[model samples]
Target: MHATTPPPSTWWSRNWKWCVPVLAALLLALFAAFVFGILMLVFGAMKSSEPYRHAMKQAQTDPAVTAALGAPIQAGWLVQGNFSSNGPDGEANLSIPLDGPKADGTLFVVAKKHAGEWRYETLAVNVDGGERIVLEDDAAMPLP
Candidate 1:
Protein backbone atom coordinates (compact mmCIF):
# COMPACT_ATOMS: atom_id res chain seq x y z
CA MET A 1 0.00 0.00 0.00
CA HIS A 2 1.25 3.55 -0.85
CA ALA A 3 1.59 6.09 1.96
CA THR A 4 -0.22 9.48 1.56
CA THR A 5 1.15 12.67 3.31
CA PRO A 6 -0.88 15.83 3.88
CA PRO A 7 0.55 19.12 2.48
CA PRO A 8 1.72 21.81 4.88
CA SER A 9 -0.75 24.70 5.36
CA THR A 10 0.21 28.15 4.01
CA TRP A 11 0.14 31.16 6.37
CA TRP A 12 -2.67 32.98 4.49
CA SER A 13 -4.65 29.83 4.19
CA ARG A 14 -4.64 29.35 7.96
CA ASN A 15 -5.25 32.90 9.35
CA TRP A 16 -5.81 35.31 6.44
CA LYS A 17 -8.64 37.37 7.94
CA TRP A 18 -6.99 38.15 11.31
CA CYS A 19 -3.42 38.35 9.97
CA VAL A 20 -4.30 40.87 7.25
CA PRO A 21 -5.84 43.34 9.69
CA VAL A 22 -2.99 42.89 12.19
CA LEU A 23 -0.36 43.50 9.53
CA ALA A 24 -2.16 46.59 8.27
CA ALA A 25 -2.36 48.02 11.80
CA LEU A 26 1.31 47.39 12.34
CA LEU A 27 2.24 49.10 9.08
CA LEU A 28 0.06 52.10 9.94
CA ALA A 29 1.75 52.44 13.34
CA LEU A 30 5.17 52.38 11.73
CA PHE A 31 4.19 55.07 9.21
CA ALA A 32 2.90 57.29 12.00
CA ALA A 33 6.15 56.89 13.88
CA PHE A 34 8.15 57.83 10.79
CA VAL A 35 6.09 60.98 10.25
CA PHE A 36 6.42 61.97 13.89
CA GLY A 37 10.20 61.57 13.76
CA ILE A 38 10.43 63.85 10.72
CA LEU A 39 8.34 66.52 12.43
CA MET A 40 10.49 66.39 15.55
CA LEU A 41 13.63 66.88 13.47
CA VAL A 42 12.18 69.93 11.75
CA PHE A 43 11.05 71.46 15.02
CA GLY A 44 14.45 70.80 16.61
CA ALA A 45 16.32 72.54 13.79
CA MET A 46 13.97 75.50 14.07
CA LYS A 47 14.69 75.74 17.79
CA SER A 48 18.40 76.29 17.18
CA SER A 49 20.27 79.61 17.01
CA GLU A 50 19.79 79.89 13.24
CA PRO A 51 16.54 81.81 13.57
CA TYR A 52 18.04 84.09 16.23
CA ARG A 53 20.96 84.91 13.95
CA HIS A 54 18.57 85.74 11.13
CA ALA A 55 16.68 88.09 13.40
CA MET A 56 19.92 89.78 14.39
CA LYS A 57 20.84 90.27 10.77
CA GLN A 58 17.46 91.77 10.04
CA ALA A 59 17.81 94.11 13.02
CA GLN A 60 21.16 95.28 11.66
CA THR A 61 19.47 96.43 8.45
CA ASP A 62 16.45 98.05 10.11
CA PRO A 63 16.56 101.84 9.56
CA ALA A 64 14.67 102.62 12.74
CA VAL A 65 17.13 100.69 14.87
CA THR A 66 20.16 102.27 13.21
CA ALA A 67 18.70 105.78 13.63
CA ALA A 68 17.91 105.19 17.27
CA LEU A 69 21.20 103.51 18.16
CA GLY A 70 23.30 105.72 15.84
CA ALA A 71 25.96 103.01 15.66
CA PRO A 72 26.82 100.05 13.51
CA ILE A 73 26.28 96.56 14.89
CA GLN A 74 29.48 95.04 16.15
CA ALA A 75 30.62 91.48 16.80
CA GLY A 76 30.51 91.85 20.57
CA TRP A 77 26.77 92.34 20.51
CA LEU A 78 25.45 89.00 21.75
CA VAL A 79 22.28 87.29 20.59
CA GLN A 80 20.55 85.14 23.18
CA GLY A 81 17.07 83.74 23.72
CA ASN A 82 14.56 80.88 23.80
CA PHE A 83 11.93 79.38 21.49
CA SER A 84 8.60 77.66 21.99
CA SER A 85 5.94 76.16 19.75
CA ASN A 86 2.36 74.99 19.94
CA GLY A 87 1.10 73.08 16.90
CA PRO A 88 1.62 75.23 13.80
CA ASP A 89 2.33 78.44 15.77
CA GLY A 90 5.61 79.23 17.47
CA GLU A 91 7.46 82.07 19.25
CA ALA A 92 11.04 83.20 19.84
CA ASN A 93 12.44 85.89 22.13
CA LEU A 94 15.89 87.18 21.29
CA SER A 95 17.89 89.55 23.51
CA ILE A 96 20.40 91.24 21.26
CA PRO A 97 22.73 93.70 22.94
CA LEU A 98 23.73 96.84 21.09
CA ASP A 99 27.49 97.00 21.64
CA GLY A 100 28.18 99.88 19.32
CA PRO A 101 30.43 102.93 19.52
CA LYS A 102 27.63 105.49 19.84
CA ALA A 103 24.95 103.62 21.82
CA ASP A 104 24.30 100.75 24.20
CA GLY A 105 20.95 99.02 24.24
CA THR A 106 19.05 95.75 23.94
CA LEU A 107 17.02 94.69 20.94
CA PHE A 108 14.14 92.54 21.99
CA VAL A 109 13.05 90.36 19.08
CA VAL A 110 9.68 88.69 18.95
CA ALA A 111 9.18 86.33 16.02
CA LYS A 112 6.39 84.04 14.91
CA LYS A 113 6.46 80.91 12.78
CA HIS A 114 4.27 80.77 9.69
CA ALA A 115 4.49 78.28 6.85
CA GLY A 116 7.48 76.58 8.51
CA GLU A 117 9.63 79.71 8.78
CA TRP A 118 10.13 82.40 11.39
CA ARG A 119 9.07 85.99 10.66
CA TYR A 120 9.63 89.03 12.82
CA GLU A 121 6.47 90.27 14.47
CA THR A 122 8.06 92.95 16.58
CA LEU A 123 11.49 94.48 17.02
CA ALA A 124 11.71 96.62 20.18
CA VAL A 125 14.90 98.32 21.24
CA ASN A 126 15.54 99.77 24.69
CA VAL A 127 18.37 102.27 24.48
CA ASP A 128 20.35 102.74 27.64
CA GLY A 129 20.38 106.55 27.45
CA GLY A 130 17.41 107.14 25.14
CA GLU A 131 13.78 106.21 24.60
CA ARG A 132 12.47 102.85 23.47
CA ILE A 133 12.14 102.22 19.72
CA VAL A 134 9.49 99.76 18.65
CA LEU A 135 9.00 98.30 15.13
CA GLU A 136 5.90 96.19 15.18
CA ASP A 137 3.03 94.88 13.12
CA ASP A 138 -0.12 96.81 12.26
CA ALA A 139 -2.00 95.07 15.06
CA ALA A 140 -0.79 94.43 18.59
CA MET A 141 2.01 91.90 18.81
CA PRO A 142 0.99 88.61 20.31
CA LEU A 143 2.89 87.35 23.36
CA PRO A 144 4.84 84.18 23.08
Candidate 2:
Protein backbone atom coordinates (compact mmCIF):
# COMPACT_ATOMS: atom_id res chain seq x y z
CA MET A 1 0.00 0.00 0.00
CA HIS A 2 1.30 3.48 -0.95
CA ALA A 3 1.00 6.28 1.69
CA THR A 4 0.02 9.83 0.69
CA THR A 5 2.35 12.68 1.80
CA PRO A 6 0.79 15.66 3.70
CA PRO A 7 0.98 19.12 2.00
CA PRO A 8 3.62 21.52 3.30
CA SER A 9 2.42 24.11 5.78
CA THR A 10 1.81 27.65 4.43
CA TRP A 11 4.05 30.56 5.62
CA TRP A 12 1.23 32.27 7.57
CA SER A 13 0.32 28.99 9.28
CA ARG A 14 3.93 28.60 10.39
CA ASN A 15 4.82 32.17 11.43
CA TRP A 16 1.67 34.13 12.24
CA LYS A 17 1.73 33.78 16.02
CA TRP A 18 5.20 35.28 16.43
CA CYS A 19 4.74 37.75 13.53
CA VAL A 20 1.58 39.27 14.95
CA PRO A 21 3.10 40.13 18.31
CA VAL A 22 6.29 41.50 16.70
CA LEU A 23 4.28 43.69 14.35
CA ALA A 24 2.20 44.96 17.21
CA ALA A 25 5.28 45.81 19.24
CA LEU A 26 6.85 47.66 16.31
CA LEU A 27 3.73 49.74 15.79
CA LEU A 28 3.55 50.62 19.46
CA ALA A 29 7.20 51.72 19.52
CA LEU A 30 6.72 53.90 16.46
CA PHE A 31 3.66 55.57 17.98
CA ALA A 32 5.49 56.24 21.23
CA ALA A 33 8.42 57.80 19.34
CA PHE A 34 6.04 60.07 17.43
CA VAL A 35 4.44 61.33 20.63
CA PHE A 36 7.79 61.96 22.31
CA GLY A 37 9.08 63.88 19.27
CA ILE A 38 6.03 66.13 19.24
CA LEU A 39 6.41 66.91 22.93
CA MET A 40 10.09 67.76 22.48
CA LEU A 41 9.31 70.10 19.61
CA VAL A 42 6.73 71.97 21.65
CA PHE A 43 8.99 72.29 24.67
CA GLY A 44 11.90 73.41 22.55
CA ALA A 45 9.79 76.15 21.00
CA MET A 46 8.73 77.32 24.43
CA LYS A 47 12.31 77.41 25.65
CA SER A 48 13.32 79.57 22.71
CA SER A 49 10.57 82.10 23.27
CA GLU A 50 11.40 85.60 24.47
CA PRO A 51 9.69 85.29 27.80
CA TYR A 52 11.45 82.07 28.71
CA ARG A 53 14.88 83.27 27.66
CA HIS A 54 14.46 86.58 29.44
CA ALA A 55 13.36 84.94 32.64
CA MET A 56 16.21 82.45 32.57
CA LYS A 57 18.76 85.20 32.00
CA GLN A 58 17.42 87.18 34.90
CA ALA A 59 17.45 84.18 37.20
CA GLN A 60 20.99 83.33 36.31
CA THR A 61 22.36 86.84 36.71
CA ASP A 62 20.40 88.30 39.58
CA PRO A 63 22.37 88.70 42.81
CA ALA A 64 19.44 87.76 45.01
CA VAL A 65 18.82 84.53 43.13
CA THR A 66 22.49 83.61 43.14
CA ALA A 67 22.81 84.23 46.83
CA ALA A 68 19.84 82.08 47.65
CA LEU A 69 20.36 79.25 45.20
CA GLY A 70 24.09 79.63 44.63
CA ALA A 71 25.95 80.38 41.39
CA PRO A 72 25.86 78.58 38.02
CA ILE A 73 22.12 78.28 37.91
CA GLN A 74 20.58 76.05 35.27
CA ALA A 75 17.06 75.67 33.94
CA GLY A 76 15.18 72.39 33.84
CA TRP A 77 13.66 70.82 30.75
CA LEU A 78 10.05 70.41 31.80
CA VAL A 79 8.75 73.97 31.79
CA GLN A 80 5.03 74.38 32.41
CA GLY A 81 2.87 77.17 30.98
CA ASN A 82 1.08 78.72 28.01
CA PHE A 83 2.67 80.90 25.37
CA SER A 84 0.77 82.29 22.40
CA SER A 85 1.56 85.02 19.93
CA ASN A 86 0.15 86.86 16.92
CA GLY A 87 2.74 89.23 15.48
CA PRO A 88 3.45 91.89 18.14
CA ASP A 89 0.56 90.84 20.35
CA GLY A 90 0.89 87.84 22.65
CA GLU A 91 0.90 86.56 26.20
CA ALA A 92 3.10 84.25 28.18
CA ASN A 93 2.67 82.73 31.61
CA LEU A 94 5.35 80.22 32.47
CA SER A 95 6.80 78.27 35.38
CA ILE A 96 10.37 77.18 34.80
CA PRO A 97 12.29 74.96 37.19
CA LEU A 98 15.77 75.98 38.25
CA ASP A 99 18.65 74.35 40.07
CA GLY A 100 21.91 75.43 41.54
CA PRO A 101 24.56 74.18 43.92
CA LYS A 102 22.70 75.24 47.01
CA ALA A 103 19.00 74.76 46.24
CA ASP A 104 16.24 74.38 43.66
CA GLY A 105 13.53 76.80 42.68
CA THR A 106 10.77 77.64 40.23
CA LEU A 107 10.86 80.72 38.05
CA PHE A 108 7.45 82.19 37.37
CA VAL A 109 6.84 84.63 34.53
CA VAL A 110 3.85 86.58 33.29
CA ALA A 111 4.40 88.82 30.32
CA LYS A 112 2.66 90.36 27.34
CA LYS A 113 3.96 91.42 23.97
CA HIS A 114 3.03 94.84 22.60
CA ALA A 115 4.48 96.67 19.62
CA GLY A 116 7.14 94.01 19.17
CA GLU A 117 8.20 94.24 22.80
CA TRP A 118 7.88 91.93 25.77
CA ARG A 119 6.68 93.66 28.94
CA TYR A 120 6.95 91.54 32.04
CA GLU A 121 4.20 91.81 34.63
CA THR A 122 5.60 89.21 37.02
CA LEU A 123 9.01 87.57 37.14
CA ALA A 124 10.17 85.85 40.27
CA VAL A 125 11.88 82.72 41.55
CA ASN A 126 10.59 80.80 44.55
CA VAL A 127 13.37 78.86 46.21
CA ASP A 128 12.55 75.56 47.77
CA GLY A 129 11.93 76.06 51.47
CA GLY A 130 13.07 79.64 51.15
CA GLU A 131 11.87 83.09 50.18
CA ARG A 132 10.91 84.16 46.66
CA ILE A 133 13.35 86.32 44.74
CA VAL A 134 11.72 88.87 42.50
CA LEU A 135 13.62 89.88 39.38
CA GLU A 136 13.66 93.51 38.36
CA ASP A 137 14.45 94.53 34.82
CA ASP A 138 15.41 98.00 33.76
CA ALA A 139 12.86 99.87 31.66
CA ALA A 140 15.68 101.36 29.64
CA MET A 141 17.01 97.94 28.62
CA PRO A 142 15.99 96.72 25.20
CA LEU A 143 13.74 93.66 24.78
CA PRO A 144 14.66 91.16 22.18
Every model's Cα RMSD, please? 12.9, 2.8
Candidate 1: pairs in clash: none
lDDT of each: 0.70, 0.94
Q: Model 1 residue 7 lDDT?
A: 98
Per residue, candidate 1 scores C-alpha lDDT tens digits across 43-127 of 4554355456665565577777777666586534235666776666788877767766667778777788876666777677787
Candidate 1 regions off by >4 Å?
Answer: 1-50, 75-78, 84-89, 136-144
Poorly placed runs, candidate 2 (over 4 Å): 140-144
lDDT of 2 by residue, 1-144 (tens): 999999999999999999999999999999999999999999999999999998999899999999999999999889999999999899999999998999999999999999998999999999999798889987636689
Full-model lDDT, candidate 1: 0.70
lDDT of 2: 0.94
| Model 2 / residue 49 / CA error / Å | 0.3
Q: Candidate 2, after superposition: displacement of residue 108 in Å?
A: 0.2
